[model samples]
Target: MEEPVRWGVLATGKIAESFARELREVPGARLVAVGSRTQASADRFAAAYGGRPHGTYRALVEDPEVEVVYVATPHALHLEDTRMALEAGKHVLCEKPLTLNLSEAETLVALASTRGLFLMEAMWMACHPVVRAVADGLRSGRFGAPRQLHADLGFVVQVPPEHRLRDPALGAGALLDMGVYPLTLADLLLGPATEVRATAVLDERGVDVDVAVAARHGEAVSVSTASMTSASPRTASLATDTGRIDLPGDFHHPAYAVWTPVGGEPERIDPPEPVLGSGLGNEAAEVGRCVREGLGESPWVPHARSLRVMQLMDDVRRQIGVRYGADAAGVAT
Candidate 1:
């Protein structure tokens, strides 16, 4: 049997904890180490998740036993954290929105390519079984030609002003945090976006709290909305020439989808394989497969696709007047 892929998790935040829990469910994967700014935080995570705890990210990435590193820091820290792991000669799976802007994302991708190491954006939704099946069906003409799509995700964020979700320095915003999901879902089901237009409501700090986006992907049009100040259905639906498909609430990691033919009754479509855990583990499984197969990037979450999404978010941010530190440093918005 193939040896399990050894893993190290950097950071001990809520997302990191969630990934740790899901990582446990991925076959051929093992949690070897976890790192945090403080020893207490690392120890706590390790104790709960079964890993060796390191007080510093540097230590965790340098752990000889760790073959792949999962960068679970906030969006603002992804570039640096992922770059560090790549420089240390470890494969990486970084959290979504990849980086603050397209330039930073390019830098990381170039680095990974130069080093010939595996690098992938942790867009868990893209690895979801239900999503893949639906996208495949759409592409294969089993669902007919996709015409239009609409997806929305939102929640009233109840956190202090200093919290990451409300802080500009931390790359906090509804668009980056919640909006990426809807946009990605549309891209997968519709194709690469060719034109994008957006509008948003920003907080006092100039961080977007609510955002709505419309884009044209080939001949199909898609609308996506995300908000941090209100609750939404968090649903997605795709209209095609012959039928329609809908994903209920929490569409990003749905267990199943509903499909209705033009003149046929609605049918439920389940994923081809069992979901690992809360859907996140499926991405872990993808990483393990790629690493063992000596592939530098996951075909399911290609580098080009991740960069395209980042570019779209950049355009949206520019139009909405939400700027990050990278933008000020002359990074293309």
Candidate 2:
């Protein structure tokens, strides 16, 4: 039997917890350790998830037993944390948005390339079965040339201003936090966006609360919306010249998809595998497979794709005037 890939989780936030819960679902994957800013937090998380707790992020990356570290830190810390892990000679899978902007993302990608280590942005949606099926179908002309698309993800966050979703320093914004889903879906279904136009409502903290973006990819056009102050359908659709594919609610982690060919009845495609704690296991498994194959990046979510997504997000933010301090404090020269 193949050896289980040892995993180290950085941060003890909700996302981290979810990743840990889902990690068990992947074959040949193991959660060996966890790191947090505080020993108390690490201990608490480790007790629940079954991993050795480290008091600091540095300690966790430095551990000789861990093969790869999942950087689950907030958006603002992704670059710093991923760089730190790569420098420590450990492979990394950082959470999405990857970094606050494209510049930071490029730096990390170059670092991982230089170190010849595995690195991937945790964009689980791209690894999802339904999304993969749709991507394959699109590539094979299952849905004739996509003509237009619309995707949205939103939820009402009734939290204090200090909440991460509302705090600028944490890279809080509808675009970064929630919008990436729809934007990524569009990119996957259509192609790289050739033009983008965006408008947003920024809160007192200078972070976007609601955002809408329209982008053109070749002859195809897409509309993406995200919000923190309101509820949206949390769905996505691709209208092709010959048919349309309707992704179920929370399109990012959809349970099923409906493909309607022109003049034909809709077909239901159920998810192929049971998702663990929101389908994160799929991405985790992809990372493990890439690492085991001695590959530095997963073909499913390549570094180039990640950089492109960051670049598009940067453009959207520029139009919306939402900037995180990290934009000015890039980690790489």
Candidate 3:
């Protein structure tokens, strides 16, 4: 049997905890360490997830036993934390919206390439079996040429003003946090967006609380919506020449989808494998497979695809008048 891939988690936030917990369900992956800004936070995470705890991210990456680092820091810290791990000679699976903007994402990708180390944005949706199956069918014409698509994700965010979801310094906005899902889904089903236009409702602090986007992807068109002030259906649908596919639940992490041909009854399609622990474990499993194969990036979530999505988000944010600290500092592209 292959040895388990040793893992380290950077940050002690909810996402980090979710990743750590789901890592357990991934075969050939083991949590080895966790790091947080404070010892108490790291210790608390370790106590629940079973890993050596470090007070600093530096210590976590420097741990000799850690083979891969899951950078779970907020959007603003992804570039710094992922860079730290890469520089420390560890592979990385950084969370989505890999950095505050496109320029920062390019820097990290370049660094990883220079070091010949594995680095993937943790865009778990791309690794989902159901999504992959659907995308393959669409690409292969099993679903015919996709014509129009729509996806939405939203929730009533009740956090304080200083919360990460409401802080511009942290790259907080409905577009980045929630809109990326629909955009990515469109990319997977249709293609790279050729044009994107957006409008948003900004909060008192100038953070976008709601956003709607219209994009053209080659011959296909798509609409994506995201919000922090309301709860949307969190659903997605694709209309093609021959049929339609619908994800009736949280499309980003869907368990199943319904397919209906132009003149046929709807058919339920399930993921090829059991969704292990909130489906987050699927990405961890992909990382383990890629690392074992000595790959620098997963074909499922390639560097180019990630960069393209980042560029799309950049366009959307620019149109919506949402700017992060990185944008203000001229670090965004």
Candidate 4:
């Protein structure tokens, strides 16, 4: 049997833990090391999966036995961690909202291409069975051009000003954290964005608490929204000239989605695997497959698409006055 790819997980945060847990379920993958800011955290994360605990991300990146390093840190740290891995000649799978701003994302993309390494944003949603089904429908014209789409992902969390969700230094805001989901959902079906106009509510700390983004691409239109101070779980739908598809609750990790044609019975889509438990693994599988194929990017969550999404986010931020600290004017340059 072929050897599983040696994976080193960087960071011991919630996303890091979740990705590591999901990696274990993916075949042809093995978690060999974990790196954390603290030795104790690294030890704890590694002990769970029989991996070596490295005291710093550099240690994990430089480990010759590790095939790839997964950067699961906060959005602000994505560029740094991914650069470290690429500099170390290791492939990388960086978490979503790929970078804090478009300039940062552009730099990372150029680096990855120059180094000829496989770099992908862990937009696991694009790899899930339900999401793929939607993509297939749109591509096959089953949904008749999918002229309309509406998706909202928001929740009310007690985020103080100091929390990452509210910290300006961390790119804390609904647009970066929760809004990326709906925005990416728009991109999945709408293709490249031609125009975008949005409005948002700002927090006392100057971060946006909620943002509603309406994007237009020729004849197709998509409204994607998110809020960090409210509860809105019953808001996921896709419409075309033919009909609308209603995704069940928890649209992010849906078990089954219903497609309804114009004045016709609703058809159900049941995915073979229940991605609800650890959907992160699906993207990990994509990374492994791309590596095996010697591809620099996965078609599911390609680096180009991530950059486009970041560009869209850049526009939304400009509209809402919620800019990353350094880029207060939100200049792309």
Candidate 5:
């Protein structure tokens, strides 16, 4: 049997906790360490997740036992946190929206490539079995040339003004946190967008409260919306002239999908239940395999694809007037 990969979690936030729960269920994976701003926080996470607690992120990355680091920091910190792990000679699986902008993502990608170390965006949605099945169907012409795509993800957040989700300095916005899901789905089925047009409503702190995006890809077009001020259907659909594929509520983490033939009844498709923890295990397993195989990037979420998505986000931000400090500093805010 292959040895389990030793993992280090670099944040003690909600997302990091979620990943730790799923990490327990992934075979050939071990949670070796967790780092947080406070020793107490790190100790709490480690006690629950089975890892050594490190008060500082630097200590966690520098630990010899940690083979990979999962970056669960807020969007503003992704680039620096990921770079630190890489420079420390550990592979990385960063959370979605790899960086605040394309330039920062490119820097990380280049660094990973140069070092010949594994690095992948933890876009759990892309690694899902059902999502993979959908990609396969599209590739095999099951959908017959996707003509249009529609997706939305949104939820109302009633938090204080200083909450990370409402703070521009922290890279809080619907587009970065929630909008990426629909945009990613669109990219998967339709390829790189050729044109993008977007509009948004910003909160008092200048972070987007709601954002709507429309883009043209090849001959196909996609429409996506995300909001932190309201709840939406949180679904997605890919339509062709002859059929349509529907991903029900929370399409980003869907368990089932439906395909409808033109003028015919809808047929549902479901992948077998995940073998381990809730969907995140798929990406964890994938990362383990990539590291063991000596691959620098995942095919499921390639560096170029990540760059493309970042570029799209940049365009959207420019149009929506959601500027971060990183934009001015030429780094991820």
Candidate 6:
């Protein structure tokens, strides 16, 4: 409702810090407060972004000066935090995988609709110009219809078994963390998958460390593999009937992508003018643009689309037997 959208951050983790730094760089975005479980962390993050410190999420959400809340908590906590922010009558921008399951995601969508609130999932890559160009090209009939897709996102999960990546309580695994990006990419372009046949490498702790999923969208198929045990970095590529789109290392961040047509030289494309700078701030820009336009969600990463992706993730969990402690305790879906 103001020149700069007042942002109330709900965590002090590395992602929270990185996103807050980006918000500072965006012209019409302002970091108003940083909230954490502890006051010290809040103070530190607020100081970093030149904002006030809130000792708890409640304090930040109820702050009159804050227009929106960015939920940067772990995967398992996304549902609860986003619900709290929406209930408080503040717009919410939550992290990916939206929720731990499809049911919770549907609940959030209904709640936002009932409450007249704006909500979005932070699939920042989808908001980038590179991804938009690819989508537009596909719809323009220039790239032709999408046929097959190959995507891989893996990282070396070098942490103790007690860490979140290993802790079932935190909803840790390769599918929810690394796999979401590639799966989302396919969903954004090729559309909803009717079915998925998957296989995975379950670690000794009963957690799936390596997962391979192949989904069918009518005749077109999308395939992806994700791992928490590999030392190799990560990579993602998209192939269409007309040409192939190549994304460099760290595919999530906006970068140079080559569009190679059949038997033709590749052309390079970048983000548009408004978001042409470092891709880090694209999500913040999306939030501001949507709010300015009086829209309830972003076309780039809509809440309904996020819910569909979460269902895919839930299906992946069902295919593999990676149940969290909360699920065991009947607290999760």
**How high is the lDDT of residue 10 in model 6?**
93
lDDT per residue (tens digit) for residues 1-333 in model 4? 777888999999888888888887898989999999999999998888668899999999999989988898878888888899999999998888889988888888889899998998888889897888878888998877678888998889795677788898887888888888878878888888799998999977778888999988788898888988888873679888998888776687777788899999999988856563457888888889899888999999988789889988888888887766557544632
Per-model TM against the reference: 0.98, 0.97, 0.98, 0.96, 0.97, 0.94
Instruction: Quantify all predictions' global Cα lDDT against the true fold.
Output: 0.93, 0.91, 0.91, 0.85, 0.90, 0.83
Cα lDDT tens digits, model 6, 143-259, are 777888887888888999877688777778899888898899889889999989888999887788999999998878999889898854466677877788887777776476788
> Quick one: how many clashes does candidate 1 have?
0
Go through the candidates in order and give the clash count of each. Answer: 0, 0, 0, 0, 1, 0
Q: Give the higher-lDDT candidate: 1 or 6.
A: 1
Which pairs clash (backbone N, Cα, C closer than 3 Å) in model 1? none
Lowest lDDT sum, 10 consecutive residues, model 3, at 324-333
Regions of model 2 farther than 4 Å from truth: 273-277, 329-333
1-333 in candidate 2: lDDT tens per residue?
999999999999999999999998898999999999999999999999988999999999999999999999889889889999999999999998899999899999999999999999999999998888889989998779999999999999887877788788888888988999899888888889999999999887788999999999999999999999887899899999998899978999998899999999999978776665578999999999999999999999988888888999988887787777776763211
- Model 5, 60: alpha-carbon shift in Å? 0.3
> Candidate 3's residue-wise lDDT over 70-90, tens digit each?
998889989889999999999
Let me know the TM-score candidate 2 reaches against the reference structure.
Answer: 0.97
lDDT of 5 at 143: 75
lDDT of 1 by residue, 1-333 (tens): 999999999999999999999998999999999999999999999999989999999999999999999999989999999999999999999999899899999999999999999999999999999999998888789999999999999999999988889988898999989999999888878889999999999888898999999999999999999999998899999999999999989999998999999999999999999899989999999999999999999999999989989989988888888888888776534
